[model samples]
Target chain A: MRRERRRVERADDVGPYRLLRLERDGLDAGEPGQFFMLEAPGRLLPRPLSVCLATPAELAFLIDPVGPGTRPLAALAPGDAIHLLGPLGRGFRLDVERPLLVGGGIGIAPLPYLSARLGGPPALLGFRTAGHAEAAALLPGAEVVIDPVLVTDALPSGHDVLACGPEPMLRALTAIYPDAQLAWEAPMACGYGACYGCAVELDGRLQRLCIEGPVVAARRVTGASTMRAGR
Target chain B: MIPVLNASGCLDALTAPDVARTLDAYVTKTVTPLPREGNPPPRIAETDVGMLNSIGLANPGIDAFLGEHLPRLAGLGIPIWVSAGGFSAADYAHVCSLLDTRAEVDTIELNLSCPNVDAPEEDALAIVAAARAATVKPLYAKLSPALPNLPGTAAAVAAAGADGLTLVNTLRGLALDPATLRPRLAAGIGGLSGPALRPVALAAVYACARAVDLPIVGVGGVACGRDALELVAAGASAVAVGTALFADPGVPGRIRAELAVLRGRVPDPGV
Candidate 1:
């Protein structure tokens, strides 16, 4: 359906490449690890975006404006006919009682939402060299990690961590925790799990991230890389 | 005539409300034996050519589907093709056996690409074998584009007694955040679908048509009537609008009206 949500609502640039918030009063159907395919005019391919927060009336996605689709999506005004497909794919599972939040880059979008859902937990969040308003604003009271030294210093002793973002950061965190649930991202064609393109390994199984997980426990990943068969 | 919509799971439940009003055949999401929560999110990822996804079989189990969503769907005034999947042959049989008894369900679409949830290394044939033993209804197995031997798989599926086929599922792809320099989606990988996959889906359709005699339902990147016509030229009896449906909800209805134009282009079967 040509949901002119894009036409009716424009994405407000929140921070750190994050460029969309479904400006509805509270139409948040999104979940952590779920994404949106942002489509604007003249852009054939929709931009893949992640939802940081999703309320029944509000839906928020943080994206880096990169190519034709994203650039225009970033330029959307307060109300535009939106053509978006989401809360597509699978979302993170916070079923565990104690999930130590671990975030890297804008992947931190889902953190506060998860924290809110999990009712808040002490976390270890990593950012780049400088501070990002989106990250700082979204993640309050969490331990911040800017470098390896910080990650080394910040990882807690017993709490299981749930992380999303830079592979290096996730890898580093996984090296530290080794058993944390890592959130991953893969390019997708169908938000449904038919395609094997968005595939990753978990406990030696080749499962599509869109369907099986954007989150897999640290111990299940066999390779340091995402996608590709153990290659 | 009632407009035949893409029986494949094309329209996301969240599309514009008008889309529901406009479509002729809106298929439901793939259902399974027990309710499936689906794969974890970071479900979608971007790519240079298109997008990818891995929404594992997330659907309310058959009982819940019959008790809950079906009533709402019945009111839609369109034929519903119930898409079902399972890891093994036995599992497929069980699910279809359940769906076969449901009233709102008019047809069954077997997902050929669902890997085992408990053991994810299995192939598509197990699903085919299961659906064969499961139901006598109009059963359609949705196949994948990236399969190693597309025609062979289609032939094998036909020999296994498939009623029809929905050719081409997503091709796996990926994207990343340059600033953080990491993968863009949480799953790290996703199924690729869009215009870029049109040729792949078409090729599979053409090959499978010659390989086997069952009606083929072509999908992948159908955004317009012209794209749908192209699938027909390649050998599809019908075309499914998957990714394009997200962008233009009315494309299916539009494609249907334009079918006569395609008939004009094709050589008469009698000749």
Candidate 2:
């Protein structure tokens, strides 16, 4: 159903990013790290922001203030109105074994919810610097390894990895464990599969960000772009 | 306030099995008078920020359209804005006269600036003249963002008696395939949408708004309320979601809600 999702509830400073929690009544069972397209109040295009957490009654997004888009997003408070088309992209995949979860900066926001979905304990996460402590803190049981120099060598090997963050971090992990499952972030043209805008090479084939995988096997990413992404 | 989407050709609104329930507005593919299957294959190509289309106004003739398809779209609540094309001005008028009689249809949109089509500018003017001569209902002219002196051109259309203007259809373009020594899309060209077309569409709306007093329906790359609002602020009476709606059916509704929020009014998303 094409129903507009208005922000009925909101909270500020959830760890590092300002979180906008939208409540819409429907059959939306949004998965963790899955995202929604929020129509920025008066912009020409909708920004495809990532979801930090999800539930049946409500869905949540953790966004940092930035650009013309995030500026308005930062100013929004409870009772403020916004529209969202959600649960649109494919999210994380938990293989139930050796899940070496990793995140960076605001990208780390998805970790906690992802951990909860994994149904168990701590996983190793590497950040760019110690100042980025908030994201590491949000995820329960995080093995915080600060300092960039040791990153390539310090990551504990021998675990199935699930990671989301800037390109550099993912590139590091991709080289380490090419077989580990990786969730990628790509710009979305349409959350539906029509435009072929948000495509990535997956196993020598094309995959659409809106339909194929915001989440995919670590081996599938070719790091190509056909469209721009949302927040 | 009316719920109408853009008639950007081959948008494939008929993607899902059930078309009626999916979109409130169903714009017919741009139709010419005779059976024109359109430009050769490899019709759509790509560009840096946007894409291009060279469909050549493919259609199965106006008679077949009315006889075979009109009944299927009848009783649908939304207005069927026929984006009409013609070999000459008389062709446009002749087709509009035929379409206006059907109670289910009312507005006739004249295609003035399709880069992929063959009609000349004077021919478009004549068609508008013809449609004006033929029908009493409103007639809208769809224009290009690329044409030199767009505002002046729009003013001319308004003076020529067009009821409204749809600013900027797909900008002409091409996309090459490195491996195939050919274009990627089947048509060799296609209309570019998404973020790439936003600025051109905006400029067109702004120019047209300043040029004429007629209501303008903004189109191109609107995927949010802010985009729509920009067109409104630029003098567009309405905006159309061409690329976005086909990509995400729920975008229009979401954009509507966000628009309510931007105005500080709590949106009642009566979903």
Instruction: Candidate 1: list runs displaced more than 4 Å.
Output: A1-38, A45-68, A73-231, B1-4, B12-21, B115-126, B257-271
lDDT of 1 by residue, A1-231 (tens): 233353334465455465466755434465666666566556554445667766655676665555556566666666655666666666777677677887777668667677777878887777765545356567688877675445547766777778887676777777787877777765554444433445566676556566666676677776446642110
lDDT of 2 by residue, A47-120 (tens): 66766666666666677665556667766788987767666677776654777677756666576668778874
Could you tell me the fnat of model 1?
Answer: 0.22
> What does chain B score (TM) in every candidate?
0.87, 0.86
lDDT of 2 by residue, B1-271 (tens): 4353654563434332233344445567777778775554333333345445555676668899898766665655556667788767877877888888887676778887777656564644566777888888788999878778888888877787899998878776666665566766555555665567778888888877878888888887787887877777677777777766644576666677777776565343221
In candidate 1, residue B35 scores what lDDT?
79
Model 2 Cα RMSD, 1 decimal: 10.1
TM-score of 1: 0.59
TM-score of each: 0.59, 0.58
Model 1 gets an lDDT of 0.66
- The number of clashing residue pairs in each candidate reads 70, 26
